[model samples]
Target: MSTPIFPIQQPASIAAAAAILRDGELVAIPTETVYGIAAAPRLQASELLLHRFYDADSWPALPLLLAPEVPLAHLARSNQWAERLRNYFWPGPLTVLLPAIADFPFALPTPCVAKRVPDYAPLWPLLRALGGVLIVGRAAHTGYPPAITAQEVAEQLADDVALILDGGRALFGLPSTVVDCIVSPPRIVQRGIISAPEIMAALQRPAERN
Candidate 1:
């Protein structure tokens, strides 16, 4: 099946992306860090489709892309460090590990959830259209290079994706930094765009504000 590719600037294209997602299909979207394959959070079929295409190691712990305005409490348990990290670096590429609220939809080996709010221009409208949260997974198959452009996404997963939203090449070809706030001191679990010292500073700066 040949998948459709759309420029994210088209209002109708964004609407189409949202529409297919509601029909339990997946869409490939550009993030500041990389292209991602995203699914609607509510539908059972969306979860099944995500797991069908992605495996534990390749797409481990599919993260939530949220609008910055989303209430943190609604998705994660409170942690002062997580809040501080978010306040400083959100609306950009920083994925924070937080304890999932009970009854959170995506079941993982652990109760921890990873969430991010990207600074990318192309995501906001579709994000709001999809209710401010999109379950995002790595766009490439296992052992493949990460997709940074809409064309790269289509090249690799054309049959699997519904629509590829082109927002040009990724702003950063690197991945988002992942911090494990599930632990005390909120250590840097995976280094990507944000530096360790910067994260450590953000974690400690909460004391300065107090």
Candidate 2:
């Protein structure tokens, strides 16, 4: 199936994009790290649809990516450890896992949820427009080589996602460093642009490899 594409420039276009998201459709928006596939929280079915369409076999079952400022309490039971991590390294390239909320959307089901907030300030209004919808999304570089340009997203995901907003290549050429915040003494699951030394200094602990 061919997917729709849109360029993000005027506010009206972004508003239209939000409407598409609310309707359970997919939109690829720009972020500092990479373009992302976004869907509204209510569109649980879209989550599965995205995975199947994109052939993203490595991702967890419940593939929704939350906005960084999204209240942790909304998705999991919070503790001091979770709070500390959130306070320091959010709105950047870091994904923290937490226990899933029972009433959480079921499109992707893992023991914990992977959440992030890309540091794209201009896109905040778009997120606000979506009203904290649980997005079944991923960096535009999901399957293909990492997208360093908007044209890359257009080339790779044009047929899979409903819309693609060309905000240009991300400053960080890599995906967020994923950390298992759900575990005690949080640990790194995947190392990306953020180096081990930086993460260790932030957490003030030695790296724990499983």
lDDT of 2 by residue, 1-210 (tens): 555555566687688888877777777777777667677766454654555444435654344455556686766666666566666666777777777777765534455567776677667777778665446455454456556556776777676667777676778767778777777888888787677777777676322312
Candidates in order have lDDT scores of 0.82, 0.65
C-alpha TM-scores of all predictions: 0.92, 0.82
What lDDT tens digits, residue by residue, belong to model 1 across residues 14-97? 999999989888899999998888888875645655565556553345578997678766567858888898888888889988
Please list the Cα RMSD from the true structure of every candidate, rounded to 1 decimal place. Answer: 2.1, 4.5
Best by TM-score: 1
Q: Which pairs of residues collide in model 2?
A: 41-134, 61-108, 62-108, 62-109
Error of 2 at 112 (Å): 1.8
Candidate 1 — what's its lDDT?
A: 0.82
Off by more than 4 A, model 2: 1-9, 43-45, 53-57, 61-69, 134-136, 139-143, 205-210
